[model samples]
Target: MKYIKGIFWLMAIACVIYAGYTLHSCRQRLANNPMGLELGFQKEINQTPVVLQSIERIGQWEFLSIDDEVMVDTTESHLLSPDDHLVRIYHGTLRLGIDFSLCDRGWATASGDTVSLRLPPIQLLDRNFIDEARTRSFYEYGTWNVQAKEDMYNRARTRMIQRAMTPQNIKQAEDNARHQVEALFRSLGYRVVRITVGRSS
Candidate 1:
């Protein structure tokens, strides 16, 4: 019975010594590095301006696309010969949106969970929208020269632009851009996003 009791006492002392050594080591580490027990949350955000910078790196952001078809006909008359008539149908796609390259340094600002952005005005993304390969000669009479066909193509392109690039279409594209931008910011942890569409100074 005495031997068992002695063994138990030795085990207890060993446990106490181990606990004391652990506590002392912990104290020493804390003394050397005072912020070991920091319980506060880190509230500073580092991705505030990175969002805009990333967007600026995207060269052309297309928000809207309009498909248009235009028919143009031209006729050349000669007194001694029959009139040469050429009718063509042109297909084009008009892409409209903000050019991120135009975004200024002060385009985006963030405060807490709120982000404000000043984006460049939405405009036609590409002027050469016509698909020349898709141009179909609807009707042709007699032989047409290259210049005549070129003139008809120009007229067709102009008509398509006029028909597709209206004020209503532009407004729709702007609205879409706002929604897209808001969604992007919200996904990036921004709760409130304010966007303004205008020419950046």
Candidate 2:
């Protein structure tokens, strides 16, 4: 009878241990699961018709001379004019390449070999904006009260300034990226021959 009682207690303890483990696993899975919110909530927000400015790279070539029009196939435009405190978007990409040359020493007594060096590609990144909004005219001073028209004009002017600054932002960002890439090449023993700004595309 004592042995039987001992066996029952052991079984109870094993069952309790198993239950604890199961509960822990359930909690872990719940923690890993998503918060059960619907996806695509942010996508719906981005789909609103806001103006976007973008630049495209249309050409690239070897660094032969500075007069070469590297941006032979690109154009620019104003993307959007803001009416109120709305947001505008601009995007662009930079395209570039590298060139190299080799030198040979004739019959060197010590090394009996040749050496090679490379020139980094001339950067051919161009900036441009693509306006997608329908054109609108400024409000007349008499139509809207003079003070109201002045306020509207001032707001529009501010928006235009902000729109114009987009390209400058792209220029600075591309410059920084190019500098970093050049530094990386220098660390790898490649000489940066030149950096050129092609025509605006």
Candidate 3:
């Protein structure tokens, strides 16, 4: 029994000493290398998978948001009756960003500490951005049919898109996407991150 107890105690002391030595070595290496990577520890060489997974997890990442209001009006004239006119104001918010679900299999590639990503170009995230409830009837004369109301709504939607989806806005959104993606890769310990905005996959 005495010999067995001695062996157990000896093993416990050896484990503690080994643990201390490992911790000290890690600290010393961390001091030498600010990156804090130890000799035996290996960072992932292929960051493509990591980056892709991270982007996908973020789902629809919105970079730019535009709020716009549009006024749409329509008039219907009758032969024997007065003309019917309707005017409405619509409010909507447009979100622009890249959808990771549209990314191709070869969207991201990594070479050593550098990573390159080909992402979809920034565009309106949702087509149905108009708030119907927020639409206010600015003016109404006579009775208006459902089709006329729908036409006015469509006109409002088109006008909003034309005003909000300008080339400058799209370029701004793309710049924001690049900045954010680079920051994300840097946080993942990548030394260099290259991103290209291309057609949606």
> How many residue pairs clash (N, CA or C atoms closer than 3 angstroms) in each of the candidate models, in the order given?
0, 2, 0
Provide C-alpha RMSD values for all models, in order. Answer: 27.4, 19.6, 26.4
> Which structure among the candidates has the greatest lDDT?
3
lDDT at position 88, candidate 2: 23
* Candidate 1 deviant stretches above 4 angstroms: 1-58, 199-201
Per-candidate TM-score against the hidden true structure: 0.68, 0.21, 0.67
lDDT of 1 by residue, 1-201 (tens): 999999999999999999999999989887887456657889986765534344333578788998988888888898999888888888899998999888889899999999999989888888789998898989999998888888887887788777777888888888999999999999999999999998422
Screening candidate 2 with a backbone cut-off below 3 angstroms (N, C-alpha, C), the clashing residue pairs are: 75-201, 79-131
Order by TM-score, highest first: 1, 3, 2
Model 2, position 134, has a per-residue lDDT of 27
Stretches off by above 4 angstroms in model 2 are 1-165
**What does the lDDT come to for candidate 2?**
0.40
Candidates sorted on lDDT, descending? 3, 1, 2
- Residue 178 local lDDT, model 2: 54
Candidate 2 vs. truth: CA RMSD?
Answer: 19.6
Q: Least accurate stretch of 10 residues (summed lDDT) in model 2?
A: 65-74
Clash pairs (backbone) in predicted model 3: none
